[model samples]
Target: MQGHRPSQKQLYDHFAPKMLGVCYRYARTLQEAEDFLQEAFITVFRKLDQYRNEGPLGKWIYRIVINTCINGIRARCRFSDTAGRIDVEHLENESTAHPAAHSEIIELVRQLPTVYMTVFNLHAVEGYPHEDIAKMLDTNVNTVRSQYSRARTLLMKKLGSGPKTNENGKRG
Candidate 1:
């Protein structure tokens, strides 16, 4: 895929759909997910020579996609939060987007605040550990854990399945 348009297009075609799903898990809208997909592919092509060929190409491409998502979050979040922090601002203009049909749960995930959604997708959907998430986000482990906790709580509450705890935080 290096310096070859047809090969690049072929690779993109083969991976774009699944990679877009990966992007969507971390993006708020379809447009944002598409943008991330394009960006990742661009990076993939640029770094094709660095692939050591020790692993499956799809896994390598997936790593690029994940890195692209995290980098996108970092780039957009820097202005909202301090350096070395992953806390991000809510999308003020998100209400204008008319998303195409997708899963109810996916839409609910997208409804979360950017930081919570990112942490949640990285840890839960991607099967990454909290420690890895903290490293990826350049944040403390406890912060990632709390963010994951908050994300789960929010999702459960939205799903009407939050822990059935009483006033004292015990099971009802």
Candidate 2:
């Protein structure tokens, strides 16, 4: 299938669900996630030619979706920052835990502050290293590390558990 090209509808049909799952991880609301998914699919189709076929198509599309989500978050942050600042402490202190039988973990993750959530998802979910995440977010590696630490702490607190330790007795 070297010379083969899937139609846009075919690509959308195959990838939309998976890509929407990725978007939902970053977005705070379902509507926002849907918007990001639509925008990402638009970008994927526009940049389809840049995919060199050296790797699986899904990986390539996943990268694009991640970039699109990051960009959307950045843009939203910029707009919100310009308008006014949010009391992150208040938001964090609010009751975030919900008694949902399913999607409780995802709901907990969504309650995290944007920076912490982004770092946590990138590191723990996407399996990106701190150094790579630093580059991707245009911040220092130490900052990413700090954010990841805080994210883990918050998550553990919300989950009503102590932090997990590795075999070496360091925080996992």
Candidate 3:
């Protein structure tokens, strides 16, 4: 069972950027994302031997990244009450230069409550099913659905419906 081990360097080279993207989505800053990614990588390495290979390695790494992001959020919230709640009013109509961080839509998503953020990211961004999210977050399936509904409502208010076509199916 212990005859062969996955190459650590190969693992890093394969998953680092994608995992970092997961970390960055839930983090407020690049430094925070880097820290989260580092911590997540440690966990991945520790649990590497437990990986059963039933699914893709990227999926396994994604779960680790998500858990790490949640842990980082919890740790920050422990020290400061302001960790989860940030005012986005002042950030409205801001320039949308940066693709991920500075994007108004992404900023709005980041402003959502932690539970909502997690649910939203898993559902909308990561394409996880409500049942899976319920299992992962230890909540009821209905709760996951409700959270996604609420998240979508909030997102619509912030990001607007996508561009509308004309009644005849031509450009508006």
Candidate 4:
């Protein structure tokens, strides 16, 4: 059904759940996620005409949601002094190790600090290159790499994976 057009309601109904999940990954609270969802949908409808069918509608909406979330994070970071200083020790203590599972991984990711979480989600989950991520976040490539590294380290520690090892089983 490439280029098939759907009504606004149809589009919202079809994509809301998945897009809310995307918002939830970036929001610190359920309320914030809902807010992001609402705001993103508003943007989606306003820009509906801009969707040129170059890609799947779902992918297009997903990009809008991600951009909305990133913008939200940037705004929050701008106003909050503690934005980048979330206490890792507290998060680690509150988190539990579970077998590799989708929900478990999402929960682990949610515990990450905002900066690290954004970088991790963009680079690892969304398959964006570090260079692209750097440009998107308006930061240097080295900073993106540092944040991604810290994010992985935090996630591994939270999941009780200790430290990662190289192919030869030596610690990285």
Candidate 5:
């Protein structure tokens, strides 16, 4: 059965916050995320008719947000080689052990190259499979897998390990 068209207000109320959060993870600043969010919503509204109910509405909205973030990254990345380098010193040591340290992780993620950022965000943050990411980016699954591994390595290096404790309450 065909799904009914969702109104702008309805869609906005349902998706804006979560989509903006997705945008924030990839955007360098809140303003940039807002801009991407606006553009993404516009695209979603225009392409709403094309949405098949085969997937959940949240997933469709997520794809639009991811695409929007990728576009923004590509635009800025064309002239910037700086994003490819990982500056481990700039990362906080606590962020590695504490998942609640979002700001530090977000900053590190922002430093990743455009290709890596898109793949990492989709696979790690958004929880999309490598096959889906490859299809979306027009690349092979192996490429996606490699990029994800690279991104994770960079993150681990940047966010360093904390003091190690053994299984029996002994410090290592």
Candidate 6:
């Protein structure tokens, strides 16, 4: 996962069982969980490496069976409604909100600490693999993964709460 790329079958064989357990955690049904696996595979195959194997969906579906396995977390992040903001509190007051607040979300992304913003952008926005981001940052893959995870956690925390300092780290 970190160095040389592996084949899709190889990836599937190695990680499918574990990931299916994850997919089953929040998905409505077994089939839905399988669908999540496929979707997760397709997403990672297309976004992470962009390589193709000429099997099934062809070469574009290569190795990347790890990081994107947790789809439930991203989809189930709870948020409180706040006008022009996403907060982590339970709001007693309901305010009118636009359907898509792209700017507000972008602002939150921008407000991430430098490392988080950089890793988040590189991985989520730029579609780089964690290894690639690690290489770019001169660090190990776990560190990159940790930063990205923390970034997502922070963003989820701020979904309706607006930016708040991470008690465990530098201000973001």
TM-score of each: 0.80, 0.77, 0.65, 0.76, 0.67, 0.38
Error of 5 at 142 (Å): 3.0
Candidate numbers sorted by TM-score from highest down: 1, 2, 4, 5, 3, 6
> Residue 94: error of model 4 in Å?
19
RMSD in Å for all candidates: 8.2, 9.3, 9.5, 7.9, 8.3, 14.7
Best by TM-score: 1
Residue 153, candidate 1: C-alpha displacement in angstroms? 0.8
Model 3's alpha-carbon lDDT is 0.71
- Candidate 5 residue-wise lDDT at 12: 87
Question: lDDT: which is higher, 3 or 4?
Answer: 4
lDDT of 2: 0.76
In model 6, the runs with Cα more than 4 Å from the true position are 1-100, 161-172
Measure candidate 2: CA RMSD.
9.3
lDDT tens digits, residue span 1-172, model 3: 2233467767787889988888878887889999999999888888878999999988888888998887787777531112111223322333334345356667788777666777777877788899997777667888777777766656655654533447795647
Model 3 segments more than 4 A misplaced: 1-7, 74-103, 160-172
Winner on TM-score (2 vs 3): 2
The models' CA-based lDDT, in order, is 0.77, 0.76, 0.71, 0.77, 0.73, 0.55
Q: Candidate 5's residue-wise lDDT over 79-128, tens digit each? A: 22222123333344455657678676787787776677777778766788
Worst 10 residues of 3 by lDDT: 78-87
For model 4, residues 1-172, the per-residue Cα lDDT tens digits are 2234467678888999999988988899999998899889888988888989998989998999998998889989841112222234433444444334557667778888888888877877788999998888888888887888778777766766557578896877
Question: Per-residue lDDT for 55-168 in model 6, tens only?
Answer: 543223322322342333235432212111223222212222543555565566667655565566567755789998676556788877777777777776676453556778
Cα deviation of 15, candidate 1, in Å: 0.8
True-structure lDDT of candidate 1: 0.77
Q: lDDT winner between 5 and 6, please give it.
A: 5
Question: Model 5 off-target regions past 4 Å?
Answer: 1-7, 52-55, 78-99, 162-172
Clashes of each: 0, 0, 0, 0, 0, 14
Report lDDT (Cα) of residue 135, candidate 6. Answer: 61
